[model samples]
Target chain A: MDEVRNVIELKDVTKDYGDFKLDRVSFAVPEGTVCGFIGQNGAGKPTTINLILDVISRDAGEITLFGQSVDRNSAALREDVGVVFDEMGFHEFMTGRDINIMMKNIYRNWDEAAFFENLRTFSLPSKKKCGAFSRGMRMKLQIAVALSHHAKLLIMDEPTSGLDPIVRNEMIGIFREFVMEEDHTILLSSHITGDLERIADEVVFINGGRIVLTGNKDEILEKHGILKCKKEDLPGISESLIVSSEVSSFGAQALINDRASAEKLYPGAVIEQAALEEIMIGYVNGKR
Target chain B: MKGLILKDLMCLKKQLTTFVYVMAGTVVISILYVLSTRYGNLARVGEQLLDQNNGMSRVDVKNLGSEAMVLFMFLPIVCVGDLMNVFVADGKAGFYKVSSSLPVPLYKRVLARFLTIYTLFGLGVLVDALLAVLLCSMTDIMSLGQFLGVIFSGASILSIYSALMILYCVLLGYGREQYAQVLALLTMAAAFVIIKFDSVRFFVVHVLGDGVGFDSSVFWKPLDFIREKGYVLLGIAALVSVCSYLLSVRIAERKRGVI
Candidate 1:
């Protein structure tokens, strides 16, 4: 993949809402890639997405979407950008057909046939009001609309936060198919790292409004490892290099981001590949 | 723009059933009132017909026709409720975020909502007027010209009121529905006070009921008032709509954070 070609770019974006501040945060999602935006709740993932979509104003920083500055061409840029929120924000009284009609006029390139096709594919009712839909159904409806719009970039804020495993897997499959085109890309933020591990090509981890780590999925998984040792040997391990450490009666496990360095430094330690969830948890709860 | 209006109409579809029921009820009540009074006293009915033939002035009957026209005022209250639903429903359901994210310009969306409410209100008033006419036709109490005059005059007042109500929806926040109802009641009370007070009779007669009577002379003054004051009301409406549009745009531009 060409890493330099960025479809979505944020440069030192900062937003201050009096009581809270989103510090200077920046990341990039290259074209034809699925960038998993991993963060715990209140990690400023949604805030960053809102700024990029220009739903909320930023105090400082530049957001570029689809290779154009978001500030200069918000309408033009939004034309090709599809967005989905964790909660379906549509009038309860409105049906799928009503939404399609409303969007048809709002979007210059709205395809009714494509929208209905997606609705049928997802088994969403055209006449059923949104208020009656279950959470999963509503999320599916939002995704159907987002994908049918021919958007190049799909920015979803926790789209799979509350879903059964089967539905979550199905959505991940749909997302994978959505990015099959060379021009298509997705930037999804979620605390559910398992789904990301299954489909994402790259991962961007944000904590307390700051980007802690960002790189290829394979590289992050391969480089970061968990070091397990007997409780007695835990005192012998170097605390400076451990990202996070968990103590238990049976043993102690420490997450070390640099697996090769940990192996060289502690030859007696048992190093095992760490899952994305464990790595995220360790990063959030810093090592003691 | 058409699509926005269609969506609003779809949302209002449930309310249409209520509107129809109220309209039918109004018609039935008016007809019943006429029947109970006119047919119960055969001798008095004969005397009324004889008086009409003798060209005796029926000013009291004309005042009653004017009073009957006030029933159309209820239309604005209902229409305001419908418009408020659009905002409250969207806010509560989180649909505003989804709709705002669409590529449509914010101003166009606001205007579409305004047009939808205005159109629906206009249609409701028209139906009420038709019902009034049908009820008046079944009795000998009001002349056809007087009945038609009442309908047209009532519709004119409703047009101005509907415009003001739309402005109210845009200027006030979500709970403005209750405020609008209170304001409507206060306006009626003020009108009644002006009608009763001898000192303000000139103002009320000139401002409130200028075109209400059959005389062409009485129509000019209030028509001019509407013309002059119409600009002020429209100007305020335009300003409020623009400001609300900008506010919504600003809200959309804010950065998301932990709430």
Candidate 2:
């Protein structure tokens, strides 16, 4: 069997801004997997993204893209990396044609035909100024630009945040199409866990500038369980297995780290598998 | 880098359109001014002034038309070349966030902005030079060499201002291009005062403080300086641009800064 390659990797990355810091962040995104970077607002998500893109300098630690250290002024590495932000960064007055003209000169492998074809497929008018575009249209335009240059890695920050469900589904379909190519990978950062649960092969959870949990999506969801019991029986559950517990008038509900162990140990208690959102909440609540 | 330059040019679209209209207006007015010097209202004004003998000469009358032509020449340059607008537009649109992610390196990004300013300045100079040729053909007040000198001087001066503004834009960061413009002007003024302290002191102490005789040649001094000393200004502009580029590259590399 061939060893899997990490398309993007950060080893103990750190960026300090006095009020907040990305404290020793480490994660490796394997090639061809969609790694959902789930974090709440002000959880250092954007800052980490900025550091990975080299839009801002990191205080310490190593960031490697495509196996090369990023600190070596590795802008050349971005030729194969595509990025999409929450906002449309293109000038309001710029048309699709204007963007094509500008980008064709920037990227060495920029394909004019594919770019316009993306515009046509996305239903974005080539001659119309992008300022007239709706929020969904703006996001689509950004996606079109990201896809046009044949990038291998797509790093999108909240690409589906504000869009209607239909548009979000459409974007998901586009992302699915992108990842269908065996070598293509995506690192999507968003607080929306539903989107991640639908598509992510791997999940990296971050909170308060720290890596909360990271692993294969299925394993994380499978290992975690919501075990509910009466208040009197709560202490009987092993201390190590309970991630966090909540008490109500009727019973006690605990999020267990090891679902199989909890089920084997307490066969009478109602134990159900956890969703990604529940797992994320359990970890966050456990931290708090 | 060429792509970034094209983006900046896109930012200047409205200004360039305004420049076209201004250029057209200047051309029509300048041609009329040229014709008026020989056979129109300006000729009558010159005759009337000569008859009155209010101590102004035919040469001074001709200099009036030259001064008017000079104003026309500077207007187009002003319309087309303002490095601040590009920064302002970038700040407004948050383009640096996208540009910073592009494969182009930081130093190249800085250079592209500097190149955009010069591209506009070059366009302004070329158009002005062509206009100069036409005006020189129709008038005897100023030679083609003199007009070209002033054009070069004006471009070089704007280049210095522009170079300083780009440095300030990088130094100050985004959403502060207005401050960059003011700071650039203030810096230029401070530098001028520092370099010409003796001349400034002489003018203040002798011309204003002591109420020394007012010389009529003071009116012609600016035109003479711009026409005769353009190459020196060009040299200074080049030096400032190189210094600004180096400094901007340093700041950008250190801060991962505004482009």
Candidate 3:
């Protein structure tokens, strides 16, 4: 078997905006995996994405894409990288054909046939102005542009936000098809944990400009559990195990980071597997 | 880099359509004025201005047609030559995010904008040159060289203004294009006043004083300078554009992601 190679790497990356700072952020996404960059709004998600793309200057540390420093020939390295932002960044007057024309000149590997085909696959009208497109259609147009080029890596910041479920699912299907190739990778950043939960092979959780948790998705989900017990019994549980807890009229529940340890410590306590949403919320609440 | 220029042109599509209209108008007006001076109502006016024997010379009186044509041509070459709309359109669309993500170096990105100014000016000058050849062939209003010289002078001046505007646009960022335009004009005006302060003061005190008469040299001297020395303006425009492009590239690279 071949040794797994990382597609994207950030080592001690730091960007300070005075009010909020991404503090020495470090993470890696191996090839052939969808790494869900989970964070709430204003949780340094877009900033991190911008830094990775070399769109913004960083105060400290380094970023590497395709095993090369972003500072050196960063523009050339983007030949294989496809980027999507939450809001459509294209001009309103531009049609799908217009984008294809502009992008064909910009990217060395731009496939004109593939671009129109992607438009067809997404049901986006080739002649209609993008300004007339609905929010969902606008996103689809961006995705179509991203996929038209033979890009090996996709970096998206909140691409699925504000879309209807059906459209979001359709986008997920497109992303799934993209990752079917062994070398393709996606670093999808969004607050929608459900979408990430359904497709992400790895997860990197961030809160308040800091990486709070990260690892394999299955391992993270398997390790975290919601422990339900009486308010009186909650005090007996180790503080190390409780990520966060809330007490109610009838009982108290705690988000236990070490579910197995909690289980061994209290045999009477009822523990249920925590969803990605529960884990995210528990971690966010724990931060506050 | 070609892609970025194409995108900027797309943003300026409205200006392009308007440019065509202005070109057609300049041609129509120049032809109509030439015909009027030769056989129509303007002929009578020219004869009277010459007959009255004012402080104006026969050369000055004869240049009335050329002066009108130069002013008319200035409308297209100077006022219509702005690339400010591109910045406004880019800002409104938030294209900075998209442009920054492309596989283009920041210096090339800045060069594309500077090149756009020349592209528009090139088109304008080309059309004006063709028109000049046609019009000067049939009439004595102005020689072809003089017409081209004046047109190029206008283009060079506007290019300088546009070059400054590009620098200001990058420094100030979006939603402030109006300020950039004003600052460019002010900078040009300050440079002119600083460079030719003595000439300006002499003209004000000796030419335009209360008892002083209308000095036809006031008008004809500058026209002669523009006709004979327009290359100076072109050289200055090139120098200003080079400086602006270098500074814009540095600022844009430092700011990172701003167009």
Off by over 4 Å in 1: A1-3, A230-240, B24-57, B70-81, B125-259
Q: Which sequence of candidate numbers ranks them by DockQ, best first?
A: 3, 2, 1
lDDT of 3 at B238: 94
Q: What C-alpha RMSD does candidate 1 show over the true interface residues after superposing them?
A: 2.9
lDDT of 2 by residue, A1-288 (tens): 989999899999999999998999999999999999998889989998888888899989999998888775567988898899999999999999999999999998898999999999999999999999999999999989999999999999999999999999999999999999999999999999999999999999999999989999999999999999999999999999988899999999999999988889999999998988888888888889
Residue range B125-227, candidate 2, lDDT tens digits: 9999999999999889789998888888889889999999999889999888889899989999999899989877877787778768455465677777786
Clashing residue pairs found in predicted model 3 = none
Q: For model 2, what is the alpha-carbon lDDT of residue B87?
A: 87
Give the alpha carbon lDDT tens digit for every residue of A187-246 in model 3: 999999999999999999989999999899999999999999998988988999999999
lDDT (0 to 1) per candidate:
0.73, 0.90, 0.89
- From the highest TM-score down, the ranking of the candidates is 3, 2, 1
In terms of docking quality, model 2 is high
Query: Per-chain TM-score of chain B, candidate 2?
Result: 0.93
lDDT of 1 at A117: 97
Predicted structure with the largest TM-score when compared to the true one:
3
